[model samples]
Target: MAVSNVYYTNMRTTLQENLLQKLERLVRKAGMMDMDFENKFTAIKIHFGEPGNLAYLRPNYSKVLVDLIRSKGGRPFLTDCNTLYVGRRKNALDHLDAAYENGYNPFCTGCHMIIADGLKGTDEVLVPIDGEYVKEAKIGRALMDADIVISLTHFKGHESTGFGGALKNLGMGGGSRAGKMEMHNAGKPFVNQELCVGCGSCKKNCAHGAITIEDRKASIDVNKCVGCGRCIGACPVDAVDSMCDEANDILNKKIAEYTWAVLKDRPHFHVSLVVDVSPNCDCHSENDAAIVPNVGIFASFDPVALDMACVDAVNRQPVINGSYLAEQEHCHHDHFKDTHPDTNWETCIDHGVKLGLGNREYNLITI
Candidate 1:
């Protein structure tokens, strides 16, 4: 593989050309318009910041891409699959409300917001990749149905993956509730008896008859439970939860395979904004101070190269004073490693390379 081209443009803007204009130029320079978008259904995958977390990419940024795609005759819609964790975005109705509350409605974005997975997070398409970890990946049906897939990622620190980039956004974010369970754990979900109110929500939602309520407590029969993660979402009290026991390296590898499943046989493009470099994922309700100063925006046809470039850019910046990274013992020279010692983000990139996703080597072309 050759060195992929990753286009970049700093946040600095003039009165005539603002940040949004710069983004348009960056993506165009990165060759986004090279694709044939006439009458195509384009899924612009993005994280609509988990309600209160202000670290997510603004709807203004997404509108830039949405408007551009529309100009090219593409029918664009902002999308993301429901999360495994209990939050505002765990189900479609709540997820749409969260998006709208965060100013991502069609009025603000010039496009509609669709929870890729259906109301219950079960509307998925089984794609068989036969990778080292995952065989058949369950991705949201709407995401897979798009004629073109574009990732508009908010690059930031993640506790599980070290950093959340294009692959993390597409791979993990594209997975249905069951698919997330497969990536996060090797075993079935267990009930937290203390949290269980015995509302029978889990038992009623279980299709396999693995859940039973006895003595005002719920228990899951592991032998019969298939780990679909429905009970986790169904529990009104959040009693049922994914074990999340997978090692970081294996989790990263599975994420790569899942990414492959999402982007396979599709015309895909990636754009990442390395701003408000938070210490944790946007899934958190609140965001801490940035670990580093705002870097810039990156776009590429190669998701691997795009992430590698953004990571490299972030590592070069000085750590922000009084931020989480500053307080941590900087044993590792890498900021992300110092911030999250146990996570190995390289596993995902290397796995992506092995799976013919894209080249790690990249040529950064400043716009």
Candidate 2:
């Protein structure tokens, strides 16, 4: 396979040129402007950082892309799907609040923020891509409707995937509530009985008739439940929950397949910043100390190659003393592995390569 070009620029900045300016320069050098953006609806997929998580990329970073896109006559919007877990971002209203609280509002990003999956997490588009795992990916309706897709990722370690990079930001982040369930579990959800109010909201929303209200309690019939995750959103008390029982390796593969479904027929670009380098995902309410020193920013049309390059850059750094990585036993000789021993981040990349997402071999072009 041929090697893709991954552009890089160190975090160093001069008095005249700040980090944001450097980022603009890097993306332009990486060929972000090569695509025809005239009148296109560009979806900039990003994590607004779960409320209280301080490690996600700031809205200032996103404004760079928003401004650039608008300059090219493209309509840009920052978007992300509702989370499967019960959090501040579980619904559109709360999700918008979390985003604005994190400074991702229109005033900051120079574009509107959209909760891709609608008021409930049930609004989705079925994208069929025959992969080994996912046959039809349930992606956010707004995300699939965009003319272009761009991922603005914050590179960090993850308990499940070892590291969260471009592909994780695109695949896992792009999934609707049900899409996330399919990737993380066996396509089934269970009710949290303690939290169930038996309001019949879930029962009313379940198209499969899998939910039953028994003695003022809600229970899901797994046999009949199609795992569309509609009930999860409809439950006012947040009683519905995903099983999340899929094996780690399988989960990674499903994420890659979902990524293919998102980017298959759209013009896409990926940009990842290896800053903060948190020990766990930004999905966490709290972010740990950095595991390693800041690497830099990387961009490419090829997400697989972009991720590969970022991982390589991160592995080359010295572990930060007193950080999570420093506290762990360094048996893997890899920072991400040593940080999250149970995870094998390679599965996603290898599966992405097999899916023809991008080449694993990349030619790093430092600017």
Candidate 3:
């Protein structure tokens, strides 16, 4: 395979061009709407900000793409899967509520929110893949059911994957609870005994009765546990968390394979917003300081190239003061890698290239 092409546009604008208008122009230049969408069920996979998180892509940015797709005759629906760790977005109902609270209503973005997995996060389609870490990937039924898959992602730092971009958005975001469990660990959520009030919320929400509270604390029985991960979200004190057993490199490779499962055979395109360059996943209800100034949006037919371009763009800009870089020296390059020395973000991209998902080398075309 050859290097993929990634198109970009800086956040600069003339007096006549505002950000929204610039976005429309950029998408066109990036060929975002170049596909034939006539009557197709298009899934616009996006992360609606967790209610309190201020770093998610604004609905206005999405509207640009949504309008473009609509004009091309695609039936577009904004979607994401239920999360693995417990939170407001663990179940479809709660997920939808969080989306609405964050201003992702149809009136706002001109799209509907479909939790990819069913109401309980069980709806999925198993896709077999001969790979190092994953044998089969459990993808959200809604995403798989769509005729076209488009991802609109927020580029940011992640404790696990070094950073979150188009690949992370699809691979991790496309997973059902079980699939997410497969990607993360060996199917278990542990309770932080100190944070547990023994409120029984976990016990109440565990569909498989895997959680039992005793001595004013909660414990999960691995034997009875279905690894549904519902209890993680149910714990008010945030006591429950998914176990992280796989080494960072292995986890990154699994994420790449999962992304391949989601995008393979689908008419797919990607868009990543580099604004509000937060230093962690938007999965957190709150966002931290921007590590870099707001870069513009990027789009590509290749997710690996898109991620690489975003990383390159970030490195080009000087670090923001008082943001996580304070008192840090020799921040030479590869800031995300610097932040997470254990993780090799490139491993995922290299694996992705090997899987024919996309090429790592790319031509950075400015729009």
Candidate 4:
């Protein structure tokens, strides 16, 4: 296996170097300063936690990167695409509201926040990947328009795909609503008539004529539906949704493929903070107790190696007393697996290697 370099630093601070200053030194040593940011439109892809989830990374850390990028003459902005599910982040207006609620405003972060997919999450650019699962990825226009992409992720356990790391953030997070449906399902969508009020918004926006209205309800014609996910964005009532039926293994593979579409041939970098250690994704409306103590901050050019190193670090830590991981049976030896037995986080890592995203093996260089 090819070995990659993953730089790490423990969550220790002193009067001389606080965590923020420590982060700057770590990234600088990891070669973030080597990138040519001059005159580049840089998109810092980050998750603005769901309104009620307090486990997301604070906006303070982002300002450090923003200042560094601007110092190098790069025009940096914080960016994320709209969500597919019904939530505060399902559209640009509401998504911005959620971000603002989480303290991600320009004044706080020294940059602007952009909902990459525009008003309804329909604004997308189709990039051909021709991978095993996804032939073409529907990425947000703003992300595709950027000259450089930097993924700043919160490393934590995920209910569906094992763990949400750099690959999840760049691949799944970079996708437009249509692209998300492709990764989460069999590239098709269904309507819940109970929530549909026959507004005909879906039917009006669908270019393929895949949706119809009857009896004050809307139904989707799967045969005619192209699975563009425009209806999911069009539905005012949030009735349209993907089946979310894709097997976790395939879901992980598709995430790797989509990650390729976002980073291939682009100037890219990744950073992940193994703090909070939440047992579930930050997408949740409410955060449960953290599963483990904070490990540290990590940086790498190889995203796969970065994720691998993070999980290893987390597994090495003793589970917190009375935490979710502590309550589970420890037979698996892996903290993430013990917490969510059905999930195999390795699928994403091995598939990432297969797709040449990065090496799963690494030399962890502690800073």
Please provide TM-scores, in order, for all candidate models, with all chains considered together: 0.99, 0.98, 0.90, 0.98
lDDT agreement with native, every candidate:
0.94, 0.93, 0.86, 0.92
- TM-score-best of 1 and 4: 1
Residue 187 C-alpha lDDT in model 1:
44
Give stretches of model 3 more than 4 Å off: 191-240
Point out the higher-scoring one by lDDT: 3 or 4. 4
For model 2, how does the per-residue alpha-carbon lDDT over 175-287 read when each residue is reduced to its tens digit? 99999999999889898888888899999988888888999999989999999988888888878889999999999999999999999988999999999999999999999
Distance from true location, Cα of 19 in model 4, Å: 0.8
For residue 297, model 4's alpha carbon misses the true position, in angstroms, by 0.2
Query: lDDT tens string, model 3, 75-171?
Result: 9999999887667797889899999888889998898889999886778999998778888898999999999999999999888888999999999
Model 2 residue runs over 4 Å out of place are none
| Candidate 4 positional error at 74, Å | 0.7
lDDT of 4 at 320: 92
Q: Assess candidate 4 and give its lDDT.
A: 0.92
After superposing all C-alphas onto the true structure, candidate 1 shows an RMSD in angstroms of: 0.8
Candidate achieving higher lDDT, 1 or 3: 1
For every candidate structure, what is the RMSD over all alpha carbons to the true structure, in angstroms? 0.8, 0.9, 2.6, 1.0
- What are the clashing pairs of model 4? none
- Model 4: which ten-residue window has the lowest total lDDT? 186-195
Clashing pairs in 2: none
